[model samples]
Target: MDMASVQLLPDDVLADILRRLGPHDLAVSRCVCKPWCAVIDARRMLPADAHLLPLSLAGFFTVSWTESLTAYFSRPCASIVVGKLDYLDTDDARSLSVADQCNGLVLLHRPTLWPDDQRVLNPVTRQWAKLPPYPHLVSPCMKQDSYQREDMYLVFDPSVSPHYEVFLFHSVPYNCYEVDVVDEDAFDPAVKKMEWPPSSYTLRVYSSKTRQWETKPFIREGEAAGTIGDMESALSPGHCHAAYWQRALYVHQHDFVIRMTLSNEKYKVIKLPLGLDVRTDDEPEHYLGKSEKGVYCALLYGNNRLGVRIWFLDEICGKMDWLLKRDINLGNLLANYPWKHGDRSWTTQYVNDEIGRSMTPAGAKFESDYSTNDNVIVPEYTVSLLGFHPYREIIFFRTSFGRAMAYQFNSSEIVDTGYLQGKGPHDCVGGSFAYTPCRMGKLSNNM
Candidate 1:
């Protein structure tokens, strides 16, 4: 009874007909043969398509804080995930960097070390996990802290839990002390009854299902946006971007948004769309994501149209806010592309000298000897968003003229998806994370 050839069924009836297929039809029924791809890879049957599809952006990691480098942008037929993390066995996996990525996990850290070995990568199943040194850096009040800033964040959800969490997020210096101080009014009423974003806070979380490191506590229901000394003012500058959604996490600190929720540990602050002035913004950038309609907040708007606006967090009825949705003006779409070094000002100085001579840092050394005519004056190109599209309405960006774009928003269309090159000229794109690939099978450095 070949109902159109099941090849005489039975591998438990072809896994009950491939469990009613969906994960893009069970990855196109594993190429329809070779015995249904060895019975779908020997019964590991790839099924949790996170509530049925919509997790395919497969590429982009970026990080490059002055060239420690993470870089991995896709498309050139995406030859199966290889961001060259060099198997992260670390003794200096080039001093690591990417401190956060979720769903398909990735936390990596070793930012110039100090108990910062932190691992946890998955780059499409080159599975990894390491993390363990951060129970408050062996507290003695963080070894008598005089200054500290911590940030980690990576909270996975193979559709609700295949177990993964990291979060950290700490800061110190509301009134740091001890320079052999003989009490300067004993720090004046503990810095006037302390309370800048503190109604309660604890957070240290780690848990890959009890592989340890705990601390939770968060309780600040509302009213308190600034003044934890504005988290050491000079307004944020970097390291603050988070998004987990549903199990809650949000966080895009400074000029509002803290959220937290992680199953009732409770936290709230949300406010960043009422004349949106992240301290007179001239772009320090902003982001917090979850897409295909849910939570979003882009905002990088260096006037004169090097645009980006986005926003959408509308909870409605229980009343949450933010509404404007999409403004996009990428300097009039790179002044109409198609340039070839003839116009848009030496094609943006030959795409910033071919992205600083073909992206450096991997062993460095890839120099360039400048050459451009038309009186070279073309220096002004910057747009960096690189996220969103967890389900589409696209939006990933880069460009100080090196290009790594995406932008879809219901097809206002712009694709290019490649080159983010850079190694100097203050090497940019310091953080970007959209990658999405997760079958979540292995990933256990056994705690």
Candidate 2:
């Protein structure tokens, strides 16, 4: 009996199978042939149900280095190591950590005692290109040896275009900007915080196709930080998050949502939904997250309940209507987490309690109420919202000791993800973020 060759299958049938495959499988499928690769690239589409699809999360990363013994200034030593999640397999022994992840390419920023070099790496293809330092680091106007990270975003879609663009939002500062700096307070009349906009943000885009970084016209969507314009009833700026929705970018500023229409290249600032908590007088515990419906606001904790409100964008420009999604009381929810509830020490204690003593079936049950910390061993601990799973209705949280956990909205159950990497004197320095991997070699050269 002869086996069927996938090569002999019609292109349509091939695409049907590839479409249903997860990202990991699709990446491996590229090696079949050039034709098969092209077909996968052109037919890339997100699954209808986000929770149903397999997530390509790569795990969070951070720069690891030693403190130098310089008399005047404390700097990091030369040997740089990137501390990734214990779950990931980033064996690259070269850099400090990844700076950003575009569609499929990761900008791995390697900092020496200084940020000596940066590079764009295709983890999927094992291809890397050394990137030049950002202009602020090398420009004459800026002081030497003092580099700060500028907010950056990668604009690319491997399925649509081979060319990728990197956007760097920065404010190049001189060593002493006191005399030349355009300080925020300089704006008179104190524009209402709600009316305040973000205009001071400048940008530079590096195009892979052009192989050069060029200044681009960046359009700020909201009022440049509120001017002293006389409006007595205006609100002040509050805490917000930058979110992408409906092919647009929205940022929570003060008490308003700043909208940027990518298609029309326009900006519009709108007030946030009433009753949704915004940081005005106190630190806000809510986060503005993107969802299929539109922009959604998830209040970390309010009235002792987890609340979710999703916005419905109106056809009339920047207008939006927010509707209440659901409220879940998370009290004692962690009490039923699926995974084992204790640390190494707790496990030892449980074993001793069971075997050392006359262990009965009822006495053998392991105690779940316990906490791990640097100082005290408390029986109970606190938990706060960190963020959401990219696609699912899973709520991610961090305990007092930095242990990450997830609670499924649909399942009404909790699971312990893992404890974060925390060690040394400054154990809290090392943290993690969610990463979504990109598929390399998926685009045609048509770009």
Candidate 3:
């Protein structure tokens, strides 16, 4: 067959060949000719995970506001800064919190006393747009004697749809009344009793397509979600992450994981590991995450921050069963390991040279500068579980000392996997998230 005939291969046949290549190589194949480019764009137009087979972990970048560094780990063990967000290009007390990540887009807002500053950012292309906060009525200004609840989430998957959305699960309190009213009009003023159940949730959703804020009574009426925290606590950033997996918003609690469907606005509860008791005050922190393995809960145990017990969920005959995956020993890893702090700066000029987009990580340099935090080498250390390596079973987390590390479940190895905060004392709220890069054009299409 002539070269023209080969280039004119059927769409499916050509796609099959392209699928075998890595995302980077597959992207380059598009430059071969107009036919190949058409085939590539056609594939992206559809919203399927299969279409993204090449993007396994192609564009993973780290945004560390504490250090004002936005980078990605170059293979062996080091971080390379592609570029920093202008909004976060300062070293002030701007409380930037990563609310959620999906399809390479992240929802960032000030997790401070005022959370009104919100934006959806595409770190790869350095493109972002402002976002409107939830309606005022749903979150009243003045305090009242009633129950309140609020949950936030960022919903986006570039391949499936260009539309990006943010959900504000909020509810205001109302006066609770009892049947034992005096003369069927009022109850005793001296003794008062509030309602037993919590208040209903009002969902406020913002869509990039319409650029509008819309509110609706939660579809599951009468179902009350408990208050996450109080006002003062809310002002301080908390790790109340709402993970988007399998097109559902998943939130973890002590007893169950709430799987709220995005399509029909319905919710279902998936119980946690049987007989698992988790508390914040004096107990291990419980965090939920999704991976190729499945939905799993990481129970951080040991008063000395010694171990993390991971449990992956399994289903047997429609019954949810929990199976322990691995119990990672931090003490073993940190017992006598040498800790080094190195400068996390690298070449990013070539990053945008090709496509004018993010760069492929050439890995980071871990040259010992002896400038790392001494606290990170302390005997006792705590950690906050982040997400995972896009394609591997490795888990990512930040130590109390502000260094991010990864635990390879299958390999039984540990390595410095990320950078979001360095010495000083961001402590832990510097905020870190794992994401794969999607094109910036997707956002513009939605607009």
**What's the CA RMSD for each of the models?**
21.2, 12.2, 9.9
Candidate 2 regions exceeding 4 Å error are: 1-55, 58-95, 110-118, 137-149, 170-202, 220-225, 228-246, 250-257, 270-281, 286-295, 301-318, 328-331, 335-386, 424-432, 441-447
Error of 3 at 348 (Å): 13
Two-way TM-score contest, 1 vs 2, winner: 2
Tens-digit lDDT string for candidate 1 (1-447): 233466567667777676776544665554455566455556542443332322466566767656556666654443344545555565457666677787667787877524458888776667788877877542122334244556778887654546788888665332222234222232244453456567777878888788878887799887777654343332453557788876787877655778888888888888776344443546446777888667888877666326687878987675678887777777777654532221111011111121322232221121121113322214356667778877666778766545556778877887655446565443676677776666563368642
Cα displacement (Å) at residue 366, model 1: 4.8
Cα lDDT of model 3 by residue, 1-447, tens digit = 334786678877866765676544555565466666556656753433233422344323344444333344333222213343444433332344456666667776665433677778776566677776667543433233333445567877543456788887542222222123112212232212321112333567888888879975444423333332221121112344556665677665333466667777776555555334433443455666666555666666666546687777674574556788887778888665555434542212211112223332222222122224542455656776766655457777766654556788888887664343332334344334556656532454224
lDDT tens readout by residue for model 2, 376-407: 33435444454455555665655544355566
Model 2, residue 225: displacement in angstroms? 6.1
Model 3 is weakest, by summed lDDT over 10 consecutive residues, at 345-354
Give the top-scoring candidate (TM-score).
3
Report lDDT (CA) for all predictions: 0.61, 0.43, 0.52
Candidate 1 residue-wise lDDT at 429? 69
Clash pairs for candidate 1: 196-227
Error of 3 at 136 (Å): 2.8
